[model samples]
Target: MADEDLDIRMFVDGKGPPDIDPYFTEIEGAEAIAQSVALRCYTPKGYAPGHNIDAPNDGVFLPDFVQSTMTPHSLFTAKTLVHGEARKVDGVDSARVSVTGDQAAQRMTISVEGEGVDGEFEFSLTVDPSGLGVTST
Candidate 1:
């Protein structure tokens, strides 16, 4: 297996008890990278312990657009931040990011495309006051 980890869905959805067989299922390769990228984009810099020394301030920096209006400049900045973090994943070779928002909904969508060791993958995440949600695309 090429980099394996416990399936995060088991924890995220609070699916039943942990003793079940499915709870311990592992995700590998591109799937693993996709999950990693989603987490990297969601985590704030300095929040994760033992972070990269060179880029101490890694991860997406979501601007406070709740109090203010969302602008093109802010969207562009978000895309850049997400792209930078996505590219830093160990198995990722390249990454592209797109950011769009709905001012009225107070939500932002971030889409990412990347080539990983196993293959190419795409996924999108939504950020709102409630929380962040990820979906594979």
Candidate 2:
């Protein structure tokens, strides 16, 4: 994900108790990258929308995550990077980037918790090490 200008930015795109949209905007973004990830992701029950590069709200957003929330980070594999926003919940900043590796195996979940976020679970996404056009809907 760190080549020259490519990156996956995490942020909240929607707000409604019943629904929220997480936007994993591609820094130096690419649409094909998002398409490729859609082909591999195993969206579990309750999440069944469509994958449209131009229509982010139509699909579940995918994001590329790092091995560490700190600096000098090692990029997680595309298969493992879960892209989502880091925001405050009750003053605790938290985020979870993950993937459902195997049905039998526990979902590969990385908890990114720190200051300034209210700890709560809304919507989340995980992206692989792709290019700049991958945006999770």
Local distance difference test, per candidate?
Answer: 0.65, 0.30
lDDT of candidate 2 over 1-137, digit per residue (tens): 23544434322331111111245555432322333223223332234323223533222233222222322232344323334322211132443454333222212333332223222333223333321122343
Q: For model 1, what is the alpha-carbon lDDT of residue 91? A: 78
Candidate 1's C-alpha runs over 4 A off are 3-22, 49-55, 61-68
Per-residue lDDT of model 1, residues 1-137, tens digit only: 43344344421432111122345656666655666666665566655412444556676545354335889988887788778777877778998888889999988888888787768888777777655666676
Clashing pairs in 1: none
- What is the Cα-based TM-score of model 1? 0.75
